[model samples]
Target: MLQAGMHAFILALGLILPLGVQNLFVFNQGAAQHRFRQALPAVITASICDTILIGLAVLGVSVFLLKIVWIKTIFLLAGVCFLLYMGYVMWKSKPAVSEDEERIFSPKKQIVFAMSVSLLNPHAIMDTVGVIGTSSMLYSDMEKYVFTAVCMVVSWIWFTALAIIGKITGMADKSGRLLGMLNKLSAFVMWGMAILMLLSLR
Candidate 1:
């Protein structure tokens, strides 16, 4: 069980360490919020989405996804669309400076964007479904559950830490110029991801 847990932790960390639309959005929310707690919706939503994906992966749902090419294509297309829209939103967004309350993400917007980036992202889905799911097959029964739980726990911890880090950075950037640059960079990342997905469809 300990071995399974450790394996899952390492694998989950590897999968999540890369920069992506989901990670950027969560970090951006952390930086944009007036308080750390205000960023909870994004972190919580993302963690929940990842938990669900990991759970399904362990249950062999990825096998179902692989056997259905059309379903995968549909998911990818929707993901690309959302990523593009998100990029536009990010490009136009201003930091949540005291004078620009309108720039901040409300709880509802946080939930929606968090869900879109997490659930609609085919790259993330495939990593969870292909890498984590395939890795989980190495275990059985109680060990399998332990592996799944560990992966979920790691994801939760990761998002929480990421937000905390972002909050720290936000606090430091009193002028908001750094955050402005970050927003533009995030837009590029989102658009790049979308283009990659579109190209893959070829």
Candidate 2:
């Protein structure tokens, strides 16, 4: 069980370490909000979406996904489009320097966007299904449960830490210029990911 937990933790950490759409969105929300607590809904929503994906993957739903090429294609296309649109939005966004001016997303908007980024991302889906799901085949019963639990815990911890980091950085840089630069960088990253997915479609 310990070994399974360790494997799951390490694997999940590695998979999530990348600067993907979900992480970028979480970080942005954290940095954009007037208070770190305001970002909790986005963070929690994202983690929940990941939990669902991981759970589905462990249940061998990925096997069914693999059999349906059209479904994968449709998801990939949608992901690409969504990423591009989000990138444009981020690029055009202006940083808010004051609480009154801060355009923080409402809880509902945050939850919806978080779910979309986490659930609609084909790369994320593939990672959970392909890597996490495949890795689970080596474990059974309690070990499997431990493994899943560890992975889910890691997701929650990582997102919380990420939000805190963003909040700290925002507090330090009151000028908002750094946040603007980050938004542009995030936009670039999203567009790059979208392009990569588009290429893979062919």
Tens digits of per-residue lDDT for model 2, 131-185: 9999999999999999999999999999999999988887888999999998899
Q: Per-residue lDDT of 5-122 in model 1, one digit per residue for the tens?
A: 9999999999998988888999989988999999999999999999999999989886698569899899889999999999999999988778577898989999999999999888
TM-scores for every candidate against the unseen true structure: 0.97, 0.95
Residue 5 local lDDT, model 2 = 95
TM-score of model 1 (CA atoms):
0.97
Candidate 2 Cα deviation (angstroms), residue 194: 1.3
Top candidate, metric TM-score: 1
